[model samples]
Target chain A: MYLCISVLVVFFQMELLTLPALRRMAICGGTHGNEMTGVYLVQEMARRQKEEGDKAWPVPLVLVLSNPRAMQECRRYIETDLNRCFTSAILSFPITDSTPYEIRRAHELNALLGPKDSKEAVDVLCDLHNTTANMGVTLIAYSPNEWICLHIYKYLKGKMTLAPVRLFMVNIPKNEAYSLESVGKNGFSLEVGPQPHGVLRADIYNYMKEAIELSVEWIGLFNSGVMIEGGEVDAYVFHKSIDYPRDPESKQITAAVHPQLQDQDFCCLKSGDPVFLSFSGETVCYKEEEALYPFFINECAYYEKGIAFHLARKTTLKIPSVRVQRN
Target chain B: MYLCISVLVVFFQMELLTLPALRRMAICGGTHGNEMTGVYLVQEMARRQKEEGDKAWPVPLVLVLSNPRAMQECRRYIETDLNRCFTSAILSFPITDSTPYEIRRAHELNALLGPKDSKEAVDVLCDLHNTTANMGVTLIAYSPNEWICLHIYKYLKGKMTLAPVRLFMVNIPKNEAYSLESVGKNGFSLEVGPQPHGVLRADIYNYMKEAIELSVEWIGLFNSGVMIEGGEVDAYVFHKSIDYPRDPESKQITAAVHPQLQDQDFCCLKSGDPVFLSFSGETVCYKEEEALYPFFINECAYYEKGIAFHLARKTTLKIPSVRVQRN
Candidate 1:
């Protein structure tokens, strides 16, 4: 009942504000049910702005409170994660035939948030999420075209605690035809952090606001037929694996250590401890390089092959300038 | 500028009402940019409702205006269809890449739209689209789960001109990993009509709005832990191509047809169509009654012959339900 009522209110409000020249931005929060920071942050911003007489709102922003059931249950989702389920197959779900509850809310939000015409306000989609293990910000983007990402990156730079690193994480394999790669344009996954408690709430809210501002500016540039600065970034791959003693009780072997680096920072290990090849592949012998590879081990897990171990190390590698490759 | 400002205002405004208890629905319009009816209809309804001074808005609807640039150009999308580019490889554009104007626009729209999340408001994601040649009200669904589609079908019945033939009209191939299917327990596509003049806008709006109401009711029923009176529908096979046609023109056969049949309409094609006996077979042929016939065509255009054929004519054959064979 509340969901229906809220949709109507927003739908009507959008009607009042409809005009050809209107600029619009759609903001998404709580993509993962556990990533509640974005959800809370948007709501708090709205509440505070209203209390302040709406003077703080700079652009027409559509704040979406996504995945209510997941939020309530504090789970990723009842059946599937909403963030990962944005495809045509959604139409097959009987519940989705008429518009699933979440889809309906998103639609209502989109209408209210999108620009009046295709040529008007810039269309922007911003999904906020937190990570379970990774500690920095990563923007999983699509296009190698820089104009789009640069605009967003400019705005998101300072507002976020960790500088956003943009990269193409996956390609549309022949098998997974419906993956986000299917969108193949410039979709991105904004991974916030390693589960920052309350920090993400504020950061995401601020990031969204900045993104809205940038969108307005970007749209104005487009309307005037101006080319924005910047180019596409290439995909960055971070494959980090540790070799555990095939035995469970034995401690993991130490390999050459890489210095700690910030997000986007990349280090090249030209020479390290002799590469001790494991069943999986080549891994730096941890124990032999302990002095050079100062590290802290997290909990260990047993995989099919061996006992897997996780560790945090430091590096002083330079962040490489990358280019996005569009398929 | 107006769009940006309006978005800012709405963003904050929606945020004000985005408390934990509020119900939400996400409605996506123009998944295929040419399907302007749903987009326009949603906008019109919101406009009319607001203009009429209706103080009470029924539901919190998030209207997603997908692919504005494509819609403006009256094309599905440039470079690549935005609908088909949702995979991870194409998520974000680079900071220095140069591409077509439409591709960049797609990226911008994605950035603006972001991903779906958990909030009370975003319970559903209604993707509205139109057909190229078929003229019917058919739903493309992810699963045949009746719990969701049955109610949607009920609400959609008699509301629009398109015939709601069955509970579900679509199923993703096992190989197709769609986002919506990956998210909810149920999902579906609301394929409106082949309206040439975009006259179906009103009907689309009415169906969508009514569907929202039905979805809300469903959420209520489910949340109350009440067992709704509906049997689960079995998963169906989604065949993109039954046979890989050897001829160029003959290859025009498509799966998206307006099936002209009553309730359970299916097809039973015999031995004449070209069949790739093995997974790696690259031959085409017309199936004769009981013989595995072969026909001469192009030598090696494709790697493997397709097991399916394009439906050239709209024929309603009383075919038995083919068991869904997983890929």
Candidate 2:
């Protein structure tokens, strides 16, 4: 369980292995305070990489464990779910005098990933997380517009049991929301499986291990390459669900594919409606007559958009916040 | 203009002032690289506070300017708007290793505000900026519920020509996107006026000067007041704009309000246009609306459900890495 804490304390103290002329790739696990598979996998990877020596990782690999304190506590961040705090206005934890352990880790990781002046420090970022419900191995690559993301995906597909996914939607028009859609960077939230699920963690670990290897291969091909085999992934079967929350503000104007049921669900949504369920064990209810109800196409789970659904609303939905161009 | 170039360099050099008994408040100006009014005011306040010889601010004030480089460059954080980088992931700027200057400032401020271990910091975050089109003073408080916000509003109103004017719909389902929305915390984004035109540096200076003063007062109340006065601004304005971005992964399932446009606008939007523009710029052509349109509400604008127009969007939005639950 003991691992190499990154040496450079100013930034991220990633378990380090130095390789000259090497590109560094950072893999983030357990971005969700509740999702800890990524943390477990990254820790394993860091341990293995450290053991295998620098040559084992063709590139320098930084394994990041998001919200370690939360991970230890088995919740997201202690008081606040750290995943939401990444907006522009709010970066670290909301601590005035003493920050929670998680915020301090975030600052450290941020500095290490991209030190104030060191542009060439960490090159690639891959965020690993798990879903509340059952999900397959997937990569959330929101950096399609960028060649770096494209190449990373290629490598990822080539190496891992990844299912290529089109980001169904993003939380747009809001500040500091992170996703492939928001930050045009090549980062994805790997929805391995439900938290504390052993099978899911194993799957996540294997896939991440492969991803690190492929990430190195991808970086190797960046500037100089003989054009060897690139990466390709399986089609990730997505469960058709809009992860948007039923907030009072959005609820007013949001034309839920089914407006009537939307309110009811928001007001009193239980569990097991159809599309998705929340980690808090809330089920979404829906009417069979609505066009978007049950959220399935021809009995196949479809991830047309990417909002996590805690409950089902009986309605046809147009996914919002998916395609904002960075100006 | 030779104010101290080293102010940029001295950013990290300053020791993190840790005083747990002291309430924590961080005021950031120039989040938008070009918005300098808050910066001017904060610096002046810092100097005056020093001159007044207050050993410790009534509250430990963490004064920060978001984008020193962009401010120096005189443009919104170009590669990536720094404001948008705080969410789940710090975005990758176009130029590799080129994080927005504001992001760097955010990191530095986060550290200084609370080193995570300090016990006395209060994280009273205020981001100050200037808007070019609007001619009003606005505060975007980060109150999660209605009651607390009303108190924040009342306190702010007494300090300035403050009006609780709602701006163009933020697509966030709830107020989670703003840093201040966290419970028991005071975070707000202040918009002064049309940048470089309406508010001169001196005018901004006055605004900043008073803000620092009011912040001190507010902190003192929190620290020692038996019964805090003016606690009535808690009626939550739940206005959801059509533009709210929805991120399903966050633990807080809140919705945002969107404005319902008229026939003149969104005419092309059929009953089920998937990615419809709920609140595009009023002045711009229908076809011309993409993201980042300048469609602020004009004079004699209607204020229904507490929504505003013509206000600029924060750089980005996402789930905070931490989640806090309130009793």
Candidate 3:
């Protein structure tokens, strides 16, 4: 009887830890300016807010366009990648006249929506992004154990019918998480694609809009004292990134993503599978011993970052269910 | 007998006018720097020339990288589009300190490959280009009556098994022709694509390489006194350009190319067909009375040019058979 009582007490404490009511949320877009779906979605929402007012949302929500200058020029970024400038170390850097444009912008954003890792930060943040690679709809989380993000991914996976929904965990520590989404207490990014930079596709734009709507709906249900149930979700955990083959002397790429592997993101790649095709008509094969899922294959923005594609190992995550804690 | 003799004399003169052998040919690439197929093909040909000493060609061939500064930066152009700076009026514009970099580069290219409309110009010039639209292997010509270009287009249609080959005529007068191709006596552009700017696709690259190789082979056959047989071919003549729906106040695009029309280049569009989808979920239909084929649909580069797509009217042209004129 004593052992049973101890087990019940442990379960009660775990539910207490999981049930904080989310009071405020933030949705950010244009972190990478050339990703048009997010930029337009944010604009669309702002227009709707002006017309309908905030009575539609159950929780207080803030909309952000992260990089206005880059969006104006239809470029990925103006000075440096804004999405990569949000780690605590970088955010704390002393401001100078010669500081990069994105770094300064990061500080202003942190002050607005984040203090990063503080209780005053928004309860949740969803930063919208797009990729040239055919990744479909992906929820990218900084931590595998982020229950709010994982539950949202599970909900989106069940709701999204136009394309396959996936969860990808970058698995970085909270303090070292570098994306704009990391500013909030429970943050993640929704990345969708095959959309080209500086161009908009209606289908892709629709998919993104649907995703944001569903995400907001899920947040509302959880905040309104509804018991949100969670279960096991399969996530692709990032392993490593591969770079394209390049000429040693000139540093120019000597090959392109092989036709067989192009647009096959999230497919298991085994050893000896074709990965790249040299400009001289030679096929370069994957050399890894173990089979792994590949994603973000041949992303246009990653060319400058020296990443051809990223490899990830699939793992199942367990999520806890709970109702909002009563004061 | 007098009537028959007059007809024979006219036919003889026409054959004589068409039979001049192509002595010097130029292959130019990188007029738009983000077009990887052209940039890489030029680099590959240059490397081959260094290795093989140009002994493989049937005539003197010049391989030109038209805009080196733009190519270096991987942008469409440094200041102004190099391809549009080739008309006689623009080419003859006196050099000034404030002249756009591409305009200055155009003068240098014209000096090397042309003295346009003169016998000193290269006999044939083939410019390579790429577009973000699904325009499968197009030969863009300045005139419908350029038999050399028509015959080459026919030959490519026969030889290219990977993609459909079609001819597109801009029909601009020779003196006012605004593209780089018009610098030579007989010139046309080999445009292929659906490739994103700053990204390379192996299949698209191979299609372009095969097209260039077949063009050079056709040149060799003609220069060696072969009778090149020709036939009637369908060509799309430029009609008009359509712009995306935009807000009057900010001039910001309010719509994207509808999903139905996104990659449907060369497909016939009827009046009242779906064309643009507004951010507010409204369908904007095509309002033209006449049915027309559309190309360059949602081209990323054309966003700044205010072109959503270009319409064309399909017309058939007759090509003439000819053998080299010998001294």
Candidate 4:
């Protein structure tokens, strides 16, 4: 009888620590107006919602087209990048008549779906994006320990057949996270590409659409009392970014990504590998001491940010199996 | 004695009608600032001129960066597209303080190299450009009868081993022409692509470089009084452009270029071929009854211009062999 009582005590403790079921979610796009896949996907969802109502979704879903003005103009942003205006400090800034359009929009978005770090925040958020780099489909999250995002990444990787799926962890604190996806209790970004800005490709659009559908399916399964089994996932952790070789006086780029390195994202680079080809027909070699994987190679949008590419360290992350807790 | 006098008279008549040797040439780039191959090729040539002096060229050459402000911002244009601002009517407009930057720059370019229909204009002009379409290497001209340009196109087609070379005739009248290359006596644009705007690829840059070098070599040979042989050349004549499917209410694009059609520039399209894929996964087929070649498929910069792709008619032109005239 004493042994039976001890077993019951342990079961009670396990129930207290179980995660709650996610009741609300948000999907956003057009944070950068030039990225067309996201813009179209969000628009498509909104059209369906208007025609059929929200009964189609298992969870209450909010569809957001961030930076409407930028999307209308078909530009990246008006004053500053909207994706970078979501940090706690930027969001709390007082509104002024002279404030940029994006910052003001950020506040409106936070009020509607975020109020971040609070219990009222949506359970999941997925912001869609596109890149000119040949990185295939990538899931970007702020933390490696975000089990919800990691499990979704694993689910997407298993289900997606057209392209390789990968996870990229930015590893920043929640308060310091700058992207629109960071506003939810469990948030991440879905980035797919090899597409140019302001241009849409049918293959790329299909990849993004498939990912969203799979993510929603996973969410519905978990909510309906299905325990999702989790395992190890290979994730790329952000290391550093490198800029193109530039002229000293003019600060204009003096070279381009080497032919060998161009379009070769997520490939390991070691010392003495050719990285750039100078306009004068000379090759520039990588000089780093250690080998690292590079992604976002020659992304069109990041040219303004002075990033030719980003390097990361690949690591295996162990995620815990999860099931929605009963009230 | 009578036969000798007749031959002398015919020779004299031919000398009077012979075309003048090209003495001055201009090469311009950055008319669309985001086309990086042109911007870098012009920069590289300027650097060589600065380091090697005028002795590097057999003819007096002028290198121009057509849109400095746009290049600095890495945008297609700041206020208006510079490429579309070169019509005679636009160039003659009175300059006001509020005049668009591109127009002001156009006037500056006109005064420096053009004075369009005058003897003082550069003998030959080659404007460099890049497109996001998989167009290989293209020489765009206003008239198929322009012997100098046709011969250059033929020469480039024979010499360029990296990519296929073809001629695209805009077929517009000189006074109504709206491009920087129209400012010269015998002018055409060398366009190469499949590279994204604001990003450079080593292969694309090399193709542009090789084309430019071969053009210069052809000019030098003609100036040195060597006969250039010409033959039948195939050129695409502009027909019409088709816009993407759009929503009636919002006027936003509702479909994207189908995967089957994307990157298949210069391919023949017939009735009932897949052309676009709607956001909801429906395939839209081509409805034109006649077969035609399509080029500039899904160009990034043309989204705002409402052009999904351009249709053209391919025709063969017979070009004549010629040698430069000597005084």
Estimate the overall C-alpha local distance difference test score of candidate 4.
0.89
Candidate 4: where is the Cα deviation over 4 Å? Answer: A1-17, B1-18
lDDT of 4 by residue, B120-227 (tens): 899999999989899999999998789999888998999999999989999999999999999999999988999888888899999999998889888888888876
Best prediction by lDDT:
4
Per-prediction DockQ comes to 0.01, 0.01, 0.65, 0.69
Query: Best candidate per TM-score, number?
Result: 3
**lDDT measured at residue A196 in model 3 versus the true structure, 0 to 100:** 79
Name the weakest run of 10 consecutive residues (lDDT summed) in model 3 chain A.
A9-18
Give the higher-lDDT candidate: 1 or 2.
2
Cα lDDT tens digits, model 3, A211-310, are 8888888888887887777667899999999999999999989888999999999999999999999877999999979999999998888888899999
Model 3 bad stretches (over 4 Å): A1-17, B1-17
Query: How far is each candidate from the true structure, as Cα RMSD in Å?
Result: 30.7, 28.0, 4.2, 5.8
lDDT of 3 at A29: 89
lDDT of each: 0.40, 0.42, 0.89, 0.89
**On a 0 to 1 TM-score scale, where does candidate 1 land against the true structure?**
0.33
Candidate 2: tens digits of C-alpha lDDT, residues B136-239: 55555433332223334455666665322322223352223523212114455666543331113333344444644665675575456333432113222223
Residue pairs whose backbone atoms clash in candidate 3: none
